[model samples]
Target: MTHKAIAFFDLDGTLLDDKSQVRPEIKVAMTQLKENNVLPVIATGRTEVEVAAIMKEANIDSDIIMNGAFIRVDGTVIFSDLYDKNLIEEVYSAARENNDAISFYNEKEIWCNEHNKFLLGAYNFIHTPVPPVNPDGYLTKPVNMLLILGQDNDNYYASKFPQLNFYRNTPFSLDTVKKTVSKGIAVKILQEKLGLTKVPSYAFGDGPNDLALFEACDIKIAMGNAVASLKEQADFITKKNTEGGIVHALKHFELI
Candidate 1:
């Protein structure tokens, strides 16, 4: 019997092009993977809405979004790790004091306290629309993640919210989640749920955040444009996303 495999991908700099578009070659490669019985799952820090727009262009659905804080397989949420109410309030207060914009994400929507130039710029960088603001609604329910845009005092935040972990996606932006949450945890859970433990699992990424993902998979692929540290740890290093790295890696491994 042949071993089944799943290809997990990080969105920015790994799967999506610089314009945030999924190129034609990538689409073809993904289709081939499915035809070959290999599943492709997107594991990223992107919100569902953000992922939805890209999926519309790329046409694949299984995803572990919000940096593994939320997991959706075929439009159904199989797992979610939400922030504690106290943690949310604490973070909200700190950002407010610093005049930094805070974006909150639930399974359904992405809301913000205020949309500043920095926040809007971050969204534009990813080609995502600016999220609506509902400051009061933030505390009303559990939030899956918080994106902080603007000045951040990392040490102060670390000491203040010791239970939460931060991933600096960009110098001006960072993501906060439960200290125990990660793409690795999501992948492990998804693999177990689907009984794919015996089969080899693969992950591709290009940043510091992808380190956990690298540690979780059987095959770790770092893109050519990936951070140097990530490339050092990769089992295989392929071309840049803009250069059709997905296709290159898939062909190199004979997944296609």
Candidate 2:
């Protein structure tokens, strides 16, 4: 392992990958990295619930999920941040009125008005089993993020629902949470708490939602398959998810 210190990784298109499985080679690399003292932590846009399932399926346990909203090890929350109900309702109202699709995220469940095709597809792609049917098990006791897909009129929705802070994220998705919450803010708090602020840090992600982390971390790499704007902001562009991006990136930085 070459890259020293802790390495914060994005899940979807960075580590867990397009195939939805952390490749054997990657898992092996991460294991070695850990042994070599390079901590690999998950930093992803996925809600904590989603990340938990994904990590469990992959048999990979080290992570800091919910865009860093929560930090945990072995299913215990070491840190947490929650969104207000007032904001959640405001965001939900906007979604209902816009006729846009919605996926509300709590630490425990990802709630949708109905089953989402794309989400189902992602599940199938990754071979992850469907989540529990109970909607009451969500984080924040309601929802923390209102994930929307603005159909035919994103600009209009953006204009109309400006109160909802929207991250024009992964194509066809708009992730809305409270305006003040961000991975960087959460990470900063966690970093300070762990006395890791002085530890060298790096982040990998593929969306505008990752902008906060890209700006805050010392090393930031965007997936080659990432949204273009994020690519532009990253310090380097790694291979696409299917092309062993995480492996290449880690090897390039000598983290593996």
Candidate 3:
């Protein structure tokens, strides 16, 4: 289907509320968007499995997940940027040295090296249960993104691995992926693959990870509760997520 316009949405603090649930108005807005021939795609730092229920609830079948390590268009997996196994092992060893746990992610599942306070906090903040423990899970599966369960030291990993990108989306963990991967890159790829390069695009976000997403879109809409950096770059600043941010922005743009 050829969409008239495309909108990329960041989940936490943008589309989903504080409790990690989608508001009823947002769901209504999504249906209205589709009815208006506007494509709504989820662009989040989360994995496919992590957002499966929410996607179904909102009737969204496309996503740029794992901060852009993977892309699924219209319920079909079209792109994936998996991590190098050796590099993942090296990072895992380093995190172990610092007593930090690492979680491995693919399209379907997430597994961590160990369950600790940081790991628990990271998942708890997202309203999800801790992934099963598997010290060598990365080697066994095609890992798309890694979560470094640590509050600080994001720069430490960046300095050590110039080949990878680290985004501290939460205070409890860092989202790690290939340096070339980002929501922006994924958006561009999606546009090209779907032959929608000339279509108007909008990106909605509230956090540091969404910065790349904003850069890739034609119109950037940041939530009122968004980080100052994102708000400064937004073409339109909508109300807080819990305050009907998604609906407000859609209405403002006449997308719904």
Candidate 4:
């Protein structure tokens, strides 16, 4: 509830570079923000295990992972949004028929039908290790998100399940979530829970999945290498990720 602002960063393309490493300048900037009492949170589409490693390596503690389906702060889970079982079935059926590789996300692990090109491609793109395949069926659990290795079928899913939202997060895959789920919603929840009413919110991202995140922030920053669509709506545009964009933007706003 103080004057300290909260900065949410998208991991893959905003904070991490092509090699999937956070730039030293960005890390230093975040450290400075910490000293100034500002909260720096990772808002990413990655799983908890991956996020755990990232946070440990980066020395960050809070995060909004799985594209806003999960929220963790000070090492405690404060919010989680799960998808409908019926809709999960619909996605599973469609993927099987189309020969698309699909993975389901729970709070603990990522399980897929099989290790295929599409799934591996996404892992490679994010510079993370390949996830395991567990075809044992994960329907009985609380599945928060789905990662499909295929083309966009947003319309089909939207028409079929009115409570779901879909978007292509990368060239090789699409991400699905409940209609009410998003990074923005997660941020709003965190803000309310923390009673940060007067503090400003800043978000940085570079993909279509980041659109909703942008909507939730007081200032939206688009990485220079971000998608054109995202750039159009940005409140500010900084350098490319590899060029120390995160640190550059923070300095530009004098947040650090």
The clash count of every prediction, one per candidate, is: 0, 3, 0, 0
Per-candidate local distance difference test: 0.86, 0.67, 0.92, 0.83
Poorest 10 consecutive residues of model 3 by lDDT? 133-142
Structural similarity to truth (TM-score) of each candidate: 0.95, 0.81, 0.98, 0.94
Q: Which candidate order results from sorting by TM-score in descending order? A: 3, 1, 4, 2
TM-score of 3: 0.98
lDDT of 4 by residue, 1-256 (tens): 2538999999888888888886667667878888877888999887787777667766677899888999988788999888777777888888887788888887688878888788888888877777777765675667888988876565665676676677787777777787788898999999988888579999999999899899999999999999999999999999999888888899999898
- The window of 10 residues in a row where model 2 has the poorest summed lDDT is 131-140
RMSD of each: 1.7, 3.6, 0.8, 1.7
How would the candidate models be sorted by lDDT, starting from the highest? 3, 1, 4, 2
Please list the residue runs of candidate 2 whose C-alpha ends up more than 4 Å from where it truly belongs after superposition: 1-4, 57-60, 73-75, 116-140, 160-164
**Model 3 Cα displacement at 155 (Å)?**
2.0
- Residue clash pairs of candidate 3: none
**Model 2 TM-score?**
0.81
Question: Residue 115's C-alpha lDDT in candidate 3?
Answer: 90
